[model samples]
Target: MKKQKATIHDIAEKLKITASTVSRALNDNPRISEATKKKVLKIAKQLNYQPNHIASALRSGKSRLIGVIVPTANRNFFSSVIRGIEEIANSLNYKIIISQSYDEFDKEVQTVEALLNARVDGIIASIGKATENFDHFEKIMNKGIPLVLFDRISNELEVSQVVIDDYLGAYQTVDHLIQNGCKRIVHFTSTQRINIYKERKRGYEDALKDHGLTVDPELIVYSNMQLEDGRKKMEEILKKKISFDGVFSASDYAIMGAMQVLKEHGYKIPEQVKLAGFGNEPFTSFTEPAITTVDQKSIPMGKITAETFFELLNSPNTDTVAKKTILKPELIIRDSSK
Candidate 1:
């Protein structure tokens, strides 16, 4: 309206250089001399030069945009992870595209395909529950762009991953319940296919074995980790008369459901039956007789995943070799558990 904005051509004209040289200098390409870079930067600042990132991505191979896929965006864990990722990414002048797979396989495939077609510089994801086949992930790796996974990952693919110490978290929670004198510990779990749930199950089983407690299959219940599943499983436990004194759940939602059922049945929490859950979700702390839970270090895990993706961008040998990073989880004691 007032005046036209300065272009690379304008900067070149002012500095008596080619537009290509101006472009390189603006981008800080090493080929451009230091003196030229300083000059271009100084003049660009004066002109208030705003580089078109999308246009530049088309011209060059880098979009400075990373795609992030998670099982659900609404979940607190994934939302916190996204925050951490954005913190690092924003500092590096990059942006992210987010997609939710809804824990479905076909949706995951479509999400990956969309991100790929968008020509993202990198992708970070947590595998969905139904994502048994990894051909969609392989396509991303084949594209030679960095694909870093976090939280939920596949054992089959060789990819960079950042995850919590699920086994340790589970083990510690169970140990605490046992130390509080709960002899019969019941585990409320998701499917065995998910690596996080699998690790949690192993930890629960191993913790019982370590403490010389009987490993009772009757005490273990698979509920797909849904709220309704938790409620039904709790009822099922009562009907079966398995005689459990403690409950450890793979998810907070499930534990909350279990708590509801327990309260309805007039069972005293911690005094009679103890409860613990994974994920230090916001609701866990606010609920009546606050829940004891394992903090997954979600924010830090997300930052680490984004950092790993950036590291691969500068690496000399670009192979899809698996790089693993695991973080310790802390157990938070609360009124729900003794």
Candidate 2:
């Protein structure tokens, strides 16, 4: 016959104490003396006792786990943010569960529900490009679980958000191009569904207006932030007989797209048409003519998001209030924009 398993009652009986005393000592409650706490922990260890995580979490209503939802973990920006979150979580004795939405709304909703089932203490997310509905996030709010949004966020949602100033970053890029004698400037962006794209577009327009230049709607082009999409859109712009001396793309990938097509067509970069991009992605520096771009402080953004999440957890009173944090993005000048 197998030996009987030792329960908290057994330990309490052995120590000649009540079960409540044993439980309080095991939990290191201040009411319990340090000697009693140490004795209980030592006996529990000797018995190889393991606390039930689910039962304890149910009692305290905290899983001490954070769930992170990103569009794609493959991208450098998202990866850096993950690193930041990991660093903070580990230091705080918490764990992280990550899921990729693949920029799909349905997948994002599913991911959130899965996290909820796991009873995560908090969630950090970057809304997917295809996410127009936020009922899924509403569930988290209704359940009183803390939520933090970074990079891509919903304008309608009331929650703590961490983001860079895309508008200022774009405005400065276009202004720099204008200063470099780029008169016929063309702006390349994505669909206005996301705030980042909309803000960047607004910045580009504002810069042009500041110089007393009227923004020609025809000069503004939209395409998905993909190399092939960039190439195709550039080809369409070329077919329209549009003459542009400068190009500002919302992403580095798009910069490469326009550059590759222009180079094949014998258009000298910085000579015929200068180019500027965003994200300051690694590849931007190695391109034929290094791409000028914006640095969104991706790593720091992640770290801050993690730190902010904990701050919210510690301050329950302020958790319900909306907190907006805007980090400044720096412009990195390179050969692409001369």
Candidate 3:
């Protein structure tokens, strides 16, 4: 059997008021008195009345929905950022749809297209590693849709974005290792053209130069910064007879893998080899020897990203310049680098 859906007329009939008055009360219009609003809402709930957002959007031309995209939601950093975005969006009576790219360029393009098709009010995204082309992002700007990016962002697009101080974080970590009597430090970075990795790699090189150490070509390993990639790269370095006393990776997962291989090779952490990584993942603290790393400040990043998107959406001037917000990173010294 099919059940009939309740509408404003049903509530009006129950309260003996006009349908127009019921509508104003449900919308919390100032013309409706608080007493009338309470009664209308009570009966509305009793009747299981559900507002049709799609119809409302068609009338108002505003969906009040924000779409968020990330590389992968499985990471603690990405999930924490989503939570922060949700906290602000919910308070503003806006809903968010989350999509993951899974580090695939094709999937990222498809997700953007789907979100646009759904007519989201705005979008917030962290670019995937496999994304090199900017056509999809350019399309969003071409349509004058508000787009805000965070963390793994690209400078190719003239959109607002939020990011942490990757260069400063990497410099601080490498400098700390140097202060602790490490000279032959190995740097694990990515081959991708992403700004985050580029900045971190530049920081590593500058730190080595500042401390009077030559940048050893053999010690610089490039990869996707995954755990298995770290293990394979470390083994390759060992096979080539490269001697490195310290390791600083752009990712905690990669550093973790490197740690495993070093242990299997009978190398003592912070004794024969010092280790540090970026992104303070939870497991970093629970390892055999807690890893020293940099905190990305995911919660605040998410909140600020969502706030920036709303600001752009509300700005009267459509020609407003894009804003870039950079937050400071914190370096946490743990037993692994001591």
Candidate 4:
């Protein structure tokens, strides 16, 4: 047996009012009397008549939906950010649709296009690693759709972006290592395609130069930020006959990889070799010696991103506000860097 869906006509019949009057009351039109509006709403609620969002959006020209795109939801950093976004969006009566890029440029483009086609009011994104093209994001600007980028952002785009001070975070980590009697320090990083990696690498270079240490090209290794990659890279470095006493990886996962290899090779942590990583991922502290890393305040970044999007939605002149907000990163000291 099929149940007939309730419509505005059903509510109108129940209230003994014209269908046009019911429609106007549902929309809260100024011409509709306050008493009529209240009566229509009460009946609609009693009838369990859910308003069609698509129809309302078409009529009102505003969809109270926000679109959020990230690389991977499995990461703790992105998960925390999503939570923050949901908290703010819920408070503002806005719904959020989330999409993932899997670090691919084409998938990111498709995700953005789908969100746009759905007529979302705004977009919050973290650029993908393979996103060398900015034209996909340009389409949003062309359509006058507001966008807020966090974490991994396009360096060329002049849109509202929220990000951490990666340079300072990296510099501080390296500085801490130097202060703790580490002269032969090595830096392990992934791709430099994104601004976060570039800034962190720059900080590493700057810190070495500031401490009267020449930047050794051989000590700086760039590979995929993966556990296997980290282990293989450490093996290659060991094969080079280098005796580095310290390592600063760009990500905790990568550090974990290196640490496993170091342990298998019988190297002492913070004694024979001190290690530090970034992102302060949950598992970083659970490791044997634990990990000293940089906390980018990811959850706060997500909350601010949602808040900024709402501000743009409410403001008449969106172009007047600052397009970028940079947050400072904090170093979480632990046994890994002892």
lDDT of each: 0.91, 0.90, 0.93, 0.89
Better of 1 and 4 by TM-score: 4
Tens digits of per-residue lDDT for model 2, 174-203: 999999988778888886889999999999
lDDT of 1 by residue, 1-338 (tens): 69887788888888999999999998889998999999999888888788876678889978888999999999899999999999999999999999999999999999998887787898999998887889998998887888899999878889988999999999999999999999999999877888999999999999999999999998888877878989999998887777888999999999999999999999999899999999999999998899999999989998998889889876879864679999999999999996
- Runs of candidate 2 with Cα error greater than 4 angstroms are 1-56
Ranking 1 against 4 by lDDT, winner: 1
Per residue, candidate 3 scores C-alpha lDDT tens digits across 235-276 of: 998888898899999999999999999999999998999999
RMSD of 3: 2.3
Ordered from best to worst TM-score, the candidate numbers read 3, 4, 1, 2
Q: Residue pairs in steric clash, candidate 1?
A: none
- The TM-score values for the models, in the order shown, are 0.85, 0.85, 0.91, 0.89
Residue 303 in model 1: lDDT = 91
Poorest 10 consecutive residues of model 2 by lDDT? 48-57
Clash pairs, model 4 backbone:
none
